[model samples]
Target: MYWSVDEVDATPYFSKTMSRNRFQIIWKFLHYNDNANLDVNDKMYKVRPVLDYIVEKFKQMYQPDKNICIDEGMMLWRGRLSFRVYNPQKPVKYGIKSYILCDSATGYCFNMRPYFGEGSSLPDTMFSLLDRLSGHGYTLYMDNFYNSVALCERLLEAQTNVCGTLRKNRGEPQVIRDLVKTDLGIGDKVVRHNDKVMVVAWQDKRLVKMVTTCHQDGMQKVDVWQKGHKDKVAQFKPECVVAYKSHMNGVDKLDQNISYYPFIRRSLNWSKKFVAYLFQMCMFNAYILYRARNPGGCNTLLKFICSVVKSWTLKVHERKGSELGEQVEEEEGAGVEDGDLEDVKHTLRAPYNTDPESRLDGDLGRHKLCYLKPTSKKLRPTKRCRVCIRRGTRRETKMMCKVCCVPLHAGQCYIDYHTTVRYSVSVQG
Candidate 1:
């Protein structure tokens, strides 16, 4: 059905007419899962083709700005999947986790990797992400999970600067952690570093720790609305902490943009769920590009989404074929008396009103011949066979006419039954 957003929203027709079937009966993926173990990640599954295609398009569609961010995001999935990750901090606590590399300023996602049970090589991912922006002097901001001394070093080697909160276990100097416990006043921060990178032990409310390959001992003053003072007092903070706070939400901001008008649907298949998320991401990235080029263009993303949906729903050619106003008025009420009514009646099909026996089995319908397997061997219905009815025998059979929804004897009986109505060939042969 051609679906306009207005029509879909105006009336809840799908639930009423189509029984709200979420999937087609014959739907099959081009790729199949070749996994020997159902417990591990199935990367070669059918959705892999579509997933690769979508991710490639997402990366090629946009060039991220100088300030990029590395972050992990969760696309919600409650299905019974082995690789589902639970991060308590995210807006969605339970989901499939993915690493996202995004533009800090514009929230344009350039690349992503799905987490598949393994604690994936974050440092390797960081270097690979900046490889796309090599020689561009981009700065990447991240949270503690993806941030490490090795990651920062690798990013620096790739000519991309890094800044983010770091865990104490990432092999930073012991003194750095000790400095935070010292009697440092509010807004006072200490830094220890060699020639390449700096680790800052900063104290504001409690102790805040950050590691960076991009900054010196420089400090910037900013107002903390809730954390610092009730009046939003300005306090000195290290430049690394300042930049990390400013740019850490690049992926999250993109999430916010797409999430406000999400297209996620409950699906049993993992690939289908991922594809829905990818579609949402693509539409949102397009919106971001649209606004950047046309600043004076539109209002909210919801309005834009509705317009796109409605546009796709419209058939331009069909509308253009419509007659002119003068022609329409001249032809109106000029048809034969019962012609339109007869045509409408002919077009509509009601189960009882329409002749069931005269109806063709359809061009695509299948009919086959097989031994009427015993009830103990097969799942087909066992009934007093229709084929034996004419022969005056009440022998039961396990075969059934699928289309006509009736049980019949197998073999020539099945062939004769379908050939009597309409079927292109004997499928069982």
Candidate 2:
């Protein structure tokens, strides 16, 4: 719609701000890290700078509330990556995974860590995520994946509290485990406690087990609707269950807000897609801070994002428009003589010969062999092999070097053209 010419499909806001070609070119060449200085050990070295900077800024900008939550968020990717994860429960079933910590009240993300496969220890991951807020008396809520009885005790030692559903075998009290196996009716409850943490197994539709370091064992009355009853009825439930339900959606809320106006799109490169996800996170965090300072202001997330886009493109649009017009005028004014016209035509038809030293010095991977795509329905694209043409023999092929933009036959012709300084001599020999 950005570049559509039809009346109904055209979006003037997009067309006026930036041309589609320019946007694509920018996306194509976007880079964050220097290839020469990359750390071979780190899997995400390509985008580490931007990722680290964003994470630091997120923590520096805002302090989270007392009640906070941790959860896993997925960045949709199905490429051949070493650390990609699959979780059927997530809306994006296959993608790169990241652990995120967010404020329960405002849904602001404070920290995030990309999963580096089984090498990363769960306990260490939790401690790294909560490094800044460890001793601040804040409560952390999460799902069974991150909640273990040992982890809860560890957090309590750092003056932090944890409340979340626990896995059956995560060193919960044996008594609670036996209780879980027993058949119980709805709202039936069993509680066990040590000096530090409390384990509760409550029976709802099925058995639900949870561990908490900071919730009372007392029951609270809540209105719940049951089958065969039209009106809601009051039922006594565990206080920890209520608190867990209320506060365990911080990361989910953050994901929901980011999903509303996603900046990411389909891409072959996982690094680029991950970078776009980081940018979206930064935008969401900015929106949170914006709403915080201006509670009554006319700034919804959509409006804020639009304003940011407009501000970024306003100057670039005017400058690029003028530059394009000047270039067009120059092309129109210049005239080619009859003698030079053929040379111009040849230059347009064949690739200009590049410097041989630079072409042969680097890794062979730098030069890509690609099939010549057909430009028109009636014609198949072909070019005279540069090496064959030089050796007094004409050859045509549907294969070309992407970097050099010169056609060559696959075997000896392609190798000689890139490797030999005088490829014609090599062909003759």
Candidate 3:
């Protein structure tokens, strides 16, 4: 992630021209330590806690506005899984589907559900997701996939209002679904209401159908002023369209933010995409919280990500520098005329020998050792690089990520050794 701040591809960031220790250790830790427990049979078990943790954090950190929205997001993953969906309409034609619930005003995700495909119904999932944040008089803006007359009535009973575009065939009387163009024209609408729920259809290009329990059958008058003409034309629109236009795209906004250089490492694991999605949600939520307090601080998502990455990388360097200083101090104190102590130069075998957080322990998940160590060290040096020698700069270099047939500089020539993102170095070895 730090490298992504300055470099585009992973190869350029972790070049074979550099010592492979740092790159291999980081790569291994990033992939293997997810802080989750997973069973072989459960598809979502790997990322369930990740998503739950992010959502719970968002809920605790921010109080959403009165309006909320529900939408679907499909990530681009063609991995082997039982419930991988294929929706040609989505940006990713084949991947897992997530039903996202976000705050309409702030675009903060409150909850999400990954489709596991074993007897999971659409309405049931939507209701369960909304159940997390009900009773707040928060109005929901949803799409036809999760909307029906029956469901809206149920939500109304819980004091939550629902406004969404609905399918004509789902829970609608045959008389209403079979309306003709002669009965309704441009700027015309019809409504069917019971005690709590209402279904309205307004004519735009075609008939736009919406079901709601939170809104009234009100028409709003808007003035259409032609640019060249001075006359103000009066047009009428349904309250559903106006409200839908205002609040229904929160989930879309979240998806757009996540697609910006996401931290999804390429892996065969299907749950990697889900975990990456959760992490993306966490970052986006954090950005939202930041913006809520400082409105003008970070203008866009990309800018927020850049600032976060740079600050974190700087902190890591500062911490490492302190540790290095402490190590040097200890080495200097080794031969303090105590007569029992050995010489400092003999004890200081390596500059990097220090305490690291990467140690295996009883926690069992993230306990793997992550420190980097070289396998062999050549006692004697060889000739300088011929190019540098010709250039009168005699720079000597030697190291390799894999088994080496030729000596090469580990820094500048990193791009020369590994031309691809694939790494042959093993962190464990």
Best by TM-score: 2
How high is the CA lDDT of each candidate model?
Answer: 0.67, 0.82, 0.67
Per-residue accuracy of model 2 over 220-265 as CA lDDT, tens digit each: 9999898899999898889999999999999998899899989899
Candidate 2, position 114, lDDT: 93
- lDDT for 16 in candidate 1 is 28
The 10-residue segment of model 2 with minimum total lDDT is: 327-336
Q: Which runs of model 2 end up more than 4 angstroms from their true locations?
A: 1-10, 317-429
> Which residues of candidate 1, in runs, are more than 4 Å off?
1-8, 12-41, 180-182, 226-230, 316-429
- Pairwise TM-score winner, candidates 1 and 3: 3
In the range 267-295, model 1's lDDT, one tens digit per residue, is 67777677778888888788887888888
Each prediction's RMSD over C-alphas, in Å, is 12.8, 14.5, 13.5
Evaluate model 2: give its TM-score. 0.71
